[model samples]
Target chain A: MSARSWNLALGLVCVAFALLAVFVWIPHDVSSGVIVQERGQTNVGDAMAPTAWCYALGALGLLLVLTSWRSRPAAKSAVASGPRITAANVRFLALLIFMLVVSLVLMRYAGPVLVALLHALGANVTDYRSLRDAIPWKYLGFVIGGTTLVAGLLALIEGRIRTRQILLALIAVIVIALIVDLPFKHLPLPPNNEL
Target chain B: MTLSLYDYVSIGLQAVFTAHPAFHVLGVPISMAVVMLVAGLLTGLIVGAIPALSGPFAMAVALPILISTFGFSAAALLPTLAFLLGVMKAATLGGSVPAILFNTPGTPDAYLTTFDGYPMARNGQAGKALRVAQFACVSGDTMSDMVLITTAPFLAVFVERYMGFPEKGALIILSMAFIGAAVGASAIKGLISAVFGLFLASIGRGDDQTPRLTFGIPDLANGFSVTVAVVGVLILGEVYQAIEDLAHQHRSKTSPSPVVDRGDQKLHWHERLALMPIIGRSGLIGITVGALPGIGSTLAATLGYAIQKRRHKGAVPMGQGAPEGIAATEAASAAVSGANLIPVLSLGIPGNVAAVFILIAIDTIGGLNPGPSVFTLNQHELNPELVMVIGVFVIMMLGNAINWTLGSMLMRRLGVLQHIPPRIMMPLVLVITVAAIYLQEGKMTSIYFALGFGVIGYLMRKMQMSGLPFVIAYILADDLERLLRQGFSASGADPWFLFSSPLAVAFLLASVVVAFTMSRNPIGKTIIKNADPE
Candidate 1:
């Protein structure tokens, strides 16, 4: 697809995904309503209050983008005169995309080591200079070794005394949260102890 | 209404010593004011120096935390104001690292710095440029802080008498026009961005529970956060450029080396003394522009750079690694950091985005109602003038002290980043950014928001749009809207009343003149010939 089409398609897909997450995915879960109500009361949501002007502005922004996009000439070829896509740029981009994806994935599941490995592999594949040097063992070892050392150091540091204090602080936060939640949670159906 | 300087000093001392223990701890007490200013500055430097972390997001996250901890006192208020001021000064100086070393601007205000700073880096003048910036920033910031302290109370009185809603509204409108005219390569684009910002500000809920434009979703009851919108558009927009970069190849092997000389580049006595004159002129530029509503440090810095560049035309070009360039830009931007506080403290009107978030800290924790009456009386029976004077003195001195000792040490470390590959650095930057967001709110969502905004910010940069003005506009949007609405309501919806105040009218006229004068673009050509008198 053309770059313009690709950008439009990707942007629309992102918007659609956000909408789906907000509406369908959120409402499907039985606990989502409770979460929403609780969140609505939070300071973050309080600041996120909806206004009529957002929609108006969003529409205007859309119009402006479309107008600007239309008035501009079709995309000038981004592919340089040398090659369609250089190996170096590909490596850089691969590494960038790998980091982004791994970060989001790490937030949910795997630890830093696994994420770092994936990033290294991505970097390796995209960074290879010539076809013959695509998987240079020495370079691969360097990327993997360097990434592991950094990740291990971080994990170790996070296990230290300072980390323990931070965890304690987190626990205190949770306790306070539960204490605050208790009255609100039990307010609707309390007084009788049900077995 | 008239508070003497002695009243201010005595009251400040009383509040610091006697008001409450929360305002102090032992003799070297950690009052809310002290905490606020110090924290703001520290956070500003940390966040701004980072590749992805930005000033607005950093400030937004810190304000709530400071409020919860300090619980509003005059003693607390000064510290928070100082924090923001220090942060502005530090961030402006800090952005030079990425700009010079990586050709990437860490902060929006540093974009122009990249133009000259990166070139200098190629020529191995990174250390020199950084040193020049540091000296300039300290000088400008000190002067601006003085201006704020000396003039805020008087300005408050004048504002109380002359500035009703209509005048305030007119001023905001005029500011929007001025910023739109001043920033970016294209005025049309700037205007479009501003209009978009104003439209975004008007979103969410209107007064009196009227739904202006929210769709069916209950979450839409409050409009999308301007922070979200801006982050999405500016940061995320910039991130898109990276994606585009991915589709191509980078040929950076021939890029400039990073072996800069750490030689005897120290400023001489004569050189140090020479800065006094440049500092004064640049300080004036910063304070004057900072006092205006929308124009901020970035523009002030640009004006300073442009003016300084005029002085050394034939002998040395500015964008080609002129020390004067670094000196003027740093001083003016830093100075504005201090001067911007004047309006915020005196009139309760935040001069920029960072200042607006600061208002939340002042109201929630400092227990001070900002604006003209702050100079008269407060709910706490505290002397407003006293708190202000002392706060300015402490913050300004502390800011300078911190810069002199600690700021340089930190900057030296950042200068080393030039050697690291962008491939390694970019990912690490992203990782650190996520950690910072998580630390700020302990929420995964803020990280997501930050990532999303980073992309937008990147795109905005690529489009050659001035993200600073738009961000400033977004921050000021609500205040401007409220003033405009209030002005209409109070004046029976008569548009003519908007220009009723003579001073406001005169200011608006002057704004027009400035806009016209700057729009001509005559200086770019004449600056060279003027420099080469022969």
Candidate 2:
């Protein structure tokens, strides 16, 4: 995208946010007025600061739009092409988000799933939360989730995964889990606490 | 009934030295503070040598663990602050290692070091270059610390005596404006980032009974954790960008090769003496720039390098293997670490990212607030906060002493760390960051919040916005609101309280002027372009 278009897009987005904030969000969300009258005394209300900032943002956005519109694009080559969110960047962001979601799901449910699986296999087992503090049970979700997060990211970045990388990732996760868990027995790692 | 300054000094010294000994060395008992300081220094050296990791990242991860280890208590304050101060000081010095050895800057501020350092490495004078950096870094840091120690108390006292609520409010505004204007490429965007941060901060419970902007979410009522928001934006955001960069590089099949040490590695006494003038000038420049709220070490290093380059008459040109070049950049950047805290110690406003963490540590630990009140010397009694400040100074001195001795030697050997691929390190950092946050907050929601902010940070970076302004503004938002409310009430609910006093008016006017001027031609962009013409 050209510099002018980039500025234009930024300005429009800012203006849209400002409009929503001032007209919709603040009024609908905030319970107080810009100024309040209580027991014969006046005071600034919760909405005052946000409202003022919204106005300022709107003005700045308009200014940005005007400046970009007024400026000529003849010497575009001279101007530095600022940071752009390319298609590749978007794809990378999507992959990262997907990886994070999957890892988090595993972190939140891996232990419980394992416990249920054991129960199905004719083994006596209780709730995962009951055994969150127990050895191996506590480390399960964190290890699996943390390892997946690390190894998956490494694979994403390196464009390939090796067994050595997976092993290293597992070791890294276990070491970190131990470092947090050993000294501070009170501190629960990740999904253990949540469960 | 009143103790003298000497009495307070004695109290502070005793407090720092009389802590529970971690161990004894040759009949001498070393306090936990000292031990932590040494540990933090070593960790800082390693952290700073890594390409993508930085001092703030180390501080962010250490803070939660430190808080957990040393619970909220007066006794815990010194050791915790000491460890952080150690990390802050040593990281600046350590960052020069990669810049000098492999030409890849370990931190943004260290980029200037590459101008002269890489060339020195190519000339097989990498050892001498590292030595020059070490001496310059320690010397400049010591000088800045001296200035901070002497000036901070007096400045804090002055602010306490003279400044009222309106003045304080205006001062914060000025700081926010200055930071926004000076930090990023576009002043408007920087201001927008800061305001957005302020808006986000206003989401939680305010003066009113009802929580603002919560949208009725139970978690929103309590507000976003500062650590989660800041660490997410500063560290995770950088991690995300770095991951993308690595992926791109992998696809392109390009990788950086490591440089090996070859030649003269020692700095002679005469050579060290000869480089003193350049170091001194750069240190002064750094101190001046750092004392301000928004202008950071990048500009300091740039200005230092530019000024010295004009005056340089060495056989090798400034950008080419000149030891003076290395000295100038290293001294200036390292000096910024200490001087940057001047505003934090005196005015209760964080001047930079490191100062923000220091303030956060103080807040989390529940003692010794950084402001004019901390420096208020009571005639009838000894001020404990003042003593804590003194203790902090003592810890800084210890850090510098360590830097002068072991830090330089450790830094010379950190060349191997430069070879560690970012592809591996960044992912590990992401996991460590999440785990650290989880350990601290013990809430999965905090992790989610952090990742959410991390995405925001990544977007902000891609848009060329500096996260420093956003993070600083977020931290200061509560203080700003409190001051504004108090100032408004004190003026009988006058709407123009911020502009009521002469000092307040001056500050607001200056803020506006600065925003307008800097918006047109940002100082950061100018200096960066000048530093690297290509």
Candidate 3:
């Protein structure tokens, strides 16, 4: 892609975003007008700032498009390298998102699943919420989820996972938990507090 | 009741010395603030020595945890601020270790250090180069702090006495415009980033009864967490980029060769004396550049090194094992740590990423506000904010003192830390950041928000957009809006309130001029091109 095309694409995107904000989002979302009068006092409303910014953004976008359109292309040797979003970047992002989703799922559900398993085994167990601050329960989800995320990312970068990497990930999670949990007695680890 | 100047100083000293004692060491009582300062300095050194980690990254991760430990009380403010100041100071000094020992720079500003430092290391003068850097860094930082202490109060008072709402609003517009224009490759894109940040910042509850731009989502009513968004963009965005870089390197089966250390790592007294003049000139340049918003230390280091190189009469060339070169770059880069706070203290405008975090800490901790009001010396009443500012000054001095004594020793020992693979460190950073946010907000939503912002940060980086403007704009958006509204109301509901005063109009015109000039040829792009013509 050339610089001209890059600017054109960026301009179009910005203009689209600005138009949507001005015409659709602001109208549907903001309850107040650009100027509001209440109790016989007139004041700038919440919509005014957002509306101004949107119009400015739109104008700038149009300016960018016009400039890119009017400007001549640089000589071959002087042409600057344009920004590229490669297929590898998409792949990496997709894998990262997948890892994050899996880790979050484990973080949110690991303790509850454990409690349910114990209950089904005829052992007395309370809900995860009640035992969020208790021993073992608080550490379970964070440790499992955190380790998975860390190790998964490591594997993604290294192209393979090893036992040493898993061990390192687990140790890192436990150490982080201790650092966060021990210093402040009232603060609960993640997902546990959510529960 | 009104307190004397002496009384305010005494109160400030007491805040740092006697407020909360963590323990006693050899019949001397150690305050929690002191302990945390030392802890933060050590952590900063370690973080800064690592190639992929930085001071801002450490500050971002440590902020929520520090807040949680200290809680939101007047007493908590000093200790939290102290730790952050410590990190800010030490990290700059520590970043030079990798630059000197290996060819890798731990932070962007340290890239200049490597030009002379790596050559020195390869030539068996690594120890001496480190010593010069350490000395130069500590000296420069202390000098910058002295300037901040002397000038900030007067600047703040001036701003307080003269600037009204209209002027203040115009100043913010000028700041955003200047930042947008100066920071990145394209001024239009940078301004767009700033405006977008403001737009995002507007998506929560305001003074009005109805939440603005929430789209009726319950979660959006409170708006995005500033901490989450900031960390996501600045730290995690970098992490994502690093991970991708590492992945690419892995596929290419290319790895950086390890550097071996074998050098006369010692600086004599005469050598230190010789480098002082260079250090002074560079420190002044750093202080000047850092006082301006959005022009960061990279420009400072480049100007410092270039000027010194032109004036070089040393046995070794400036770029090849010249002690003067190391001293000049290190001094200028380190000096920026303190001088950048000048704007934050006087105008309540953050000039850089570190200042942004400092402002966030003050806002989150909620006892102190950095602005002209902070310097208001009430004749008959005790101004606690003034005392806090003094206390901060005390912390900065302490940080510099520690850097002088122990920083050089730590820098030498940290050469091994440069070997930590980004592939491993980045993942752990991601997890730790997530956990930190979760611990602070105790909500899954905040984590999700942080991740979302992290993606934005990553994309922005790929597109060559500077995140500093976006983050600063986000932080300042509320203040800008408030000032605008106040100005309008004060002007009898006139829509042209921002243009009412000559000073305000001048500021607006300057902003437009800066935007147009810088858009045509951005200083950052020009400096980088000059520094590395390849």
The per-prediction i-RMS, to one decimal, reads: 14.5, 1.3, 1.3
Candidate 1: segments with Cα more than 4 A from true spot? A1-195, B1-4, B10-80, B95-132, B210-212, B225-251, B254-266, B293-306, B313-326, B346-366, B377-381, B384-393, B408-413, B419-470, B492-534
- Could you give the CAPRI-style class of model 2? medium
Q: Rank the candidates by TM-score, best first.
A: 3, 2, 1
- Per-candidate count of clashing residue pairs (backbone under 3 Å): 54, 0, 8
Colliding pairs, model 2: none
lDDT score of residue B84 within candidate 2: 90
lDDT (0-100) at residue A20 of candidate 3? 97
For A1-195, candidate 1 gives per-residue lDDT tens digits of 343443344334334543553455423421212112233242111112222223333443444346445744444664122112235534544544455555355333332334356568775333212221222221232233223322322232233335543343334333332332243332111000110
What C-alpha lDDT does candidate 3 achieve relative to the native structure?
0.85
Q: Say which prediction, candidate 2 or candidate 3, comes out ahead on DockQ.
A: 3
TM-score of chain A of each: 0.28, 0.92, 0.91
Stretches of candidate 3 above 4 Å error?
Answer: A74-81, B251-265, B521-534
Candidate 3 per-residue C-alpha lDDT over B405-470 given as tens digits, one digit per residue, 9 for 90 to 100: 889778889988977878788889998899889878889889889998989988887666778788
Give residue A138's error in model 2 in angstroms: 1.2
- Highest DockQ against the true fold, candidate: 3
Output the lDDT of residue A191, model 2.
75
Off by over 4 Å in 2: A74-80, B250-264, B521-534
- Considering summed lDDT, which 10 consecutive residues are worst modelled in model 1 chain B? B525-534
